[model samples]
Target: MPKAQETVLEINLKALKHNFEYLKSKLNTNTKFLAVVKAFAYGSDACEIAKYLQKLDVDYLAVAYVNEGVALRNAGITKPILVLHPQAVNFKLLIERCLEPSLYNAKILNEFIAVAQQEKQTSYPIHIKFNTGLNRLGFCEKDIDYITSKIAETSSIKISSIFSHLAASEDLNEKEFTLKQIESFKTISKNMIESLGYKPLLHICNTSGILNYPEAHLDMVRSGIGLYGFGNSEKENKNLKPVATLKSIISQIHHIEKGETVGYNRAFKSDGFLKTATLPIGHADGIGRQYGNGNGFVTINNKKALIIGNVCMDMIMVNITNIDCKEGDEVIIFGEKPSASIFAQTVNTISYEVITGVSQRIKRKLV
Candidate 1:
């Protein structure tokens, strides 16, 4: 509740640790915990989050692209970094920075092997991704022999782990599909293990997957949103402490008479004498245009302030007629009260989109 700038994302390290420990408590002692820090650590500052996780002895860290892994490396993160979807052109850079790439196709596998050989690298760690059910970016069941035979030809790179992604792991209704995915992954991985002659660390569980599929914890587990403080279910969310609280100060206040319009294109017309407050946040800052037209709300003075007009690139207007607030009054966009999950639901999205969508222009203060 300290005085904040126009807009800020306050990251409570204490709450982050609380959620981390809570999720870790659900795992067995031997399960390797891999923290996914991709997308700026879910838009909470990747370097800072990865540094904290490294201190906690997190076995692995993951990012979507190679540059993200490079940023963490530049920040002095030396843990096993996984580039989930690496391009061939960055293969040399990945090797130079010691960032392991997840090779899901023959092109990436062959390219990485070529680079490793050129660098005289041997036994470098690389993760294998399989398309169990998600059908995103992963090798198929038919690619088992293709992968095993190819990797066996060279000692430049070695299989560090074999992993897959669950499609509907959190949905209780998709329990049957989740089980099938797990079984398919097991079958594919068994073929891999027998062919490779060694068991690389295997994993397929995201946050929801971890909560719903304890039996398939395999050799390790990966968690992203769970670490940032969100469970897929309301019951689980109650047990987790949300880590980031988005707050802003009321920049300006005005009183408009009936028939007066607010924002661009007369998107909102005042029904009566109404009070509104302008905030220094908008679509460019991650609360996009779709949130306008009364679709979003902010909390001020413990009262709900519905967004009354179009969300501009750098500002938004919220109805504050019912609340006693001033120009500098603090407002909560998403926090302990509205909660990221609650705020996201108001806009037909999830907490991940809301939190990670927060742009880098807004300063992140790690409290």
Candidate 2:
């Protein structure tokens, strides 16, 4: 790719393919792959990512809301899209778009059933979510009987899969908790299978779960961060290539003398003569305010230029006194060298937050 002329996010499909194949290599030959393309494919272009993944023969796609699924459908994505958190209001639209919903509780299940029945649909695929441990969403173990009974009463919808979310599959310190969650999911699956008299597709592993727990890779595995080139650990990260590279160009250069302040609220007072490079990217572009005052740094001409003063809404000034750089020079916010994970660590956040927080206003170039 050529040097960025302006603030841009370069989405490398080759890197995405590499990450997908790498994650798939860990799964069994028969296991299915569900690419989670929610939150605009982790702040990249979801439609483009979904199109590429669909070409790669991904078994399924998942989005967090009905509108997201509808967006993919509008983008000509015909794969089975699992709406991970479908709401009652959009049940009609969800069905019209052929998007499957993950019914987690009694009210959602009953409401969806009513909508399916009203739509005169038959055997519409739906996923049942069980709250194994992630207490965020899903039915409790005790609700299995009610769920089965509710299913028995309606043929309008059918259980396509049973799934759960793992809270801490990435942290080894929570191994005991993760194992218990997996074991609980297994028990729930058994009971569900026995009650329903047939087995639905069983899956509970997310990207971290796919990396950390091989025993729990049931029928299918869902990967979000892994597909975006993060493994959630130092060892696994080495094997995955980052898919997004944020790049910008120096808009101007400024020479600051001692006692001169920079940016809003006079956040930085230069102690000595120095030069600064202003890049056209800031909080609005996802480089938050927390990454100011020497906390965050960017790469310029192969040198690390610390971000000085407070970050503005549309620009950030980085000290580049020693670096051999000029206006219009390429600047790297985060990429393979200073990966998103490393950049996010400056503000005590995670790659998921940083990557997904990128503003949609920035132009995305797919390569």
Clashing residue pair totals per candidate (backbone < 3 A) = 0, 0
Residues 112-157 of candidate 2 have per-residue lDDT tens digits of 9999999999999999999987889999999999999999998898
Worst 10 residues of 1 by lDDT: 1-10
User: How much is 328 displaced in model 2, in angstroms?
Assistant: 0.1
TM-score of model 2 (CA atoms) = 0.99
User: For model 2, what is the error of residue 122's alpha carbon versus the real structure, in angstroms, after optimal superposition?
Assistant: 0.6
Give candidate 1 misplaced runs (Cα > 4 Å): none
Q: Mind giving the per-residue lDDT tens digits that candidate 1 earns over 1-367?
A: 5767679999888887888898888899999989999999988899999999898889999999999999999999999999999999999899999999999988889999999999999999999999987878998999899899988899988999999999998899999999999999999989999999999999999999889899999889999999888889999999888888899999999999999999998999988999999999999999988889899999998899999889999999999988988999888999778899999988799999999999999999988
Error of 2 at 365 (Å): 0.3
True lDDT of residue 81, candidate 1 = 94
Model 1 Cα shift for residue 14 (angstroms): 0.9
- lDDT (0-100) at residue 223 of candidate 1? 94
Highest TM-score against the true fold, candidate: 2
